[model samples]
Target: MSAAHDLPTTARPLSPEQRAADLRAMTEGELDVLVIGGGVVGTGAALDAVTRGLRVGLLEARDWAAGTSSGSSKLVHGGLRYLEQLDFGLVREALRERSLILHHLCPHLARPVPFLYPLTHRVWERFYVGSGIALYDTLGGRKGVPGHRHLSRRQALREFPGLRADTLVGAIQYHDGQVDDARHTMFLARTAVHHGALAASSARVTGFLTEAGRVVGARVHDLETGEDLEVRARHVVNAAGVWTDEIQDMAGGRGSFGVRASKGVHVLVPRERIQSSTGLISKTATSVLFLIPWGRHWVIGTTDTDWSLDLAHPAASRADLDYLLEQANRLLAHPLTHDDVVGVYAGLRPLLAGESDATSKLSREHAVVSPVPGLTIVAGGKYTTYRVMARDAVDAAVAELPDAVPSSCTEKVRLVGADGYEADWNRRHRLAAEHGLHVARVEDLLHRHGSLVHEVLALLRADPDLARPLAHAPDHLRAEVVQAVRAEGALHLDDVLARRTRISITVPDRGVEAAEEVAELVAPVLGWDQVRAAREVRAYRERVAAERASQAEPDDSRADAARLVAADLRTGA
Candidate 1:
């Protein structure tokens, strides 16, 4: 068969043993490409390269989506605000990507979400906002999702009873895509692995392997086992996101491009706090606020400001919370307070620097540069456009290869869980009944795992106790905790609580109450001893406490200090 016809198969389960094997494989021979950083772009780049039949390896210092990818507004849309800035091309590109994800690539993980844009002015505001929304709908085309619709104040209030009467004269409702960013990124890596890419998380790159003033591969430190390995590759692609500069320094000096970190914070409030049928979007003084619908909660966020502090933990200050609460209160009939916020999270965006002083004004358009003969660096793009960034980075890397490489076929590639999802969903009731579970529980698993949900179901069959819910957080099944370590690459308790499942951010105690129980459940799978399991539980508690303290701080510096109180468990703090 021609390499061009290579298609992804059902992803092999991302177990710890598989991760160790991947690291060993990278050291044995020279790979065509070595991807550094495991964010959306990094994993996406790995997927893009492997689909082209290139031998590829992916490395991450932390777990997948531990960086900016997981901490997003969770909306995949054409930049509605960008339309006002006249960045029509960017908007159109994002809309097309949004449509692709909604209908083709990851329909199981990504779904249509409606947002209401309230208009304050009677005449001009409606005409102006409606036109932009109409353009947004037009750009998205007719098939994937619904179009925009205009509503009067009365009709709008009927649709969204949470809106304050004085907030707007009318509203425009539109559709966009939403996803579980962390799981989606993990799935992307699994898809790459399925198509023959070596993938490992918690493997930190210590330095670049260089010869005769050219790049070769990297020296990596395995965090889990405390072992070091050398990885050799003809071409190295850096999709390190905000840490692009650090990776460049390891390579020698600053590559032709620069990235600036911008902090964005979000708070999760209980669903009943907002009596709305659809999500809410409105302009803030600096950027915008989105009230997105999470399962049993509403995520309201985002303050975009320049961040120069710690990249790993972007602290959400009291002022950040106040700003969001104040803005959200303006639109809500019932004001939300600090007591109402169940969880808070902050993430940093890597924007292309030197364009403008304001981080918000910086371009999200990614750049791929070949600073050295064997190294390629790609940075600065939104999560919605990661595939394009990945494609471009691979193209640049392939240009340096001595031989011709196949073109990117990732656009046609449906992620591992996407294939046969519709059929699986149609049989969800039958599957649920056979498994002795509710249909809604199966639906949740289907959305999280798609057609591969059968794998999770097999675990329940092997052990019936896996069917029980977590004592503290009932939304997730106990089997998921075991699956996180056994199947997905969840090494630490934090990985299971924070990313693999959203227990850390969904529950009011931030998974502290469930940490001990969940840790015990996963300990056997991960081979954690009693002492190690206790330490993991303690680390998670410290993390939650630090985040709480950080959120209480009045300013960024203070917040950063508070958050730093809990050093990363992976780093042995």
Candidate 2:
């Protein structure tokens, strides 16, 4: 290997200064490709383009993965239920992607998680479900994760003691990949930057820049500074998730294809509530319900229903919460009530609109189209296959270019912190000793930052005060809050408490009690005054209150109304 090939793929830090530099670079010269949206696909598209040696610029209306990307079920499965629908191709494609992520692309952030499917019927259910799981394992090639294994009722109960005895006669255990979706997406954006892509969050595309009849680039408004500029590009790709239709309209009018929004909600409970060694996946009347294990909590979710309400903040209704709780409680020995929920969240999936009346029946398959001469729109896909979607989108976007554009090299590109991760993990105990912390803390940091945990430890070594855990949230060190701003592009307290860390949903207070401390910790890096810090805290508390109020409402209308009560700190609702 050459010296260049031997060099590590370093992750460039995303800071306030870097954001300003990226914004400046976006306006200085015309980019080869300009991508809209900061979700998984958008960031993935940027990574794909930049690695192909294209001059790329990515813009996001809000923080990275603040949308549906962050709010997913956090699974990178092959859509096990899709097998029942006979969508073998989609399942196969997703399974391949899952394998790639688990073993190659993002091993540190994504890992294999086991899911137990409880059989209600003895002979028929076991045969039927067993065949499907076998096909699922076969389709996936069973390279990175484990294959399906059949278990008797006694064995099933041993794996999950909290399950009701009457719920199942036997079970089948299978493996799927799990991730910290928010951090994964953020890392994607950062990796793109490391590979030479200019990206800015809270930068909204207000309008499209046009030539006589051909699309040119985009007119963006910086939400942070309230400055507007025209960013010219050779080709512009819109990867907005559920907001695809809105972007299409901004381009000119609705395109030939349409994207519909399907609402899915999830709730968090204490991990002790489910005494299971493995996760649970059960069939529901409308869709599938997952009781996946989070760090210290269990994430029980989701109801799939057509939604036509606020796109930015989709509210979780009382019915949605009740439906999930009811469905999950059916199989649990001890039923969980509203009081057991520590956090509540809702996200909208951008499904391709077509013949099926049911939103759940909508296609997860994606489409990439050049709506105009210099504009491309890509949407409609599951999070697991974002890389394929991005690769296809870029291929379409660069087809009309005058010069030859290289094919995507992202498949071979390991994400930042992924390189040398295994070796770093093996030395974690030594790292803990060197840093004067417990092995558990070192392991947690390693998982969160992979090889870059050294950078975070450096911060703690400089400021001993940062070594202590946050007052309200003890799981995270105060240095992580500073790291969120200094390295992860966290501009506001909510960014730190919510996306940058899992404090918001994982904590009982939804990070309300930690809001002030976090705000103060990030204030210096973000250049916030004491008054601004106080304001950020107040806004975060109000936002949490509004979310709680919305979760109490019976329907979408009341829920949306309650959620809107707390105006968006950046956009003011």
Q: Estimate each model's TM-score.
A: 0.97, 0.98
In candidate 1, where is summed lDDT lowest over 10 consecutive residues?
Answer: 1-10
Give residue 552's error in model 1 in angstroms: 0.5
TM-score of 1: 0.97
Q: Look at candidate 1 and tell me the lDDT of residue 484.
A: 76
Model 1, range 346-373, lDDT digits (tens) per residue?
9999999975899889988889998888
Which candidate achieves the best lDDT against the true structure? 2
Error of 2 at 131 (Å): 0.8
Off by over 4 Å in 2: 1-10
Q: What is the lDDT of residue 534 in candidate 2?
A: 89
User: Against the correct fold, how does model 2 do in TM-score?
Assistant: 0.98
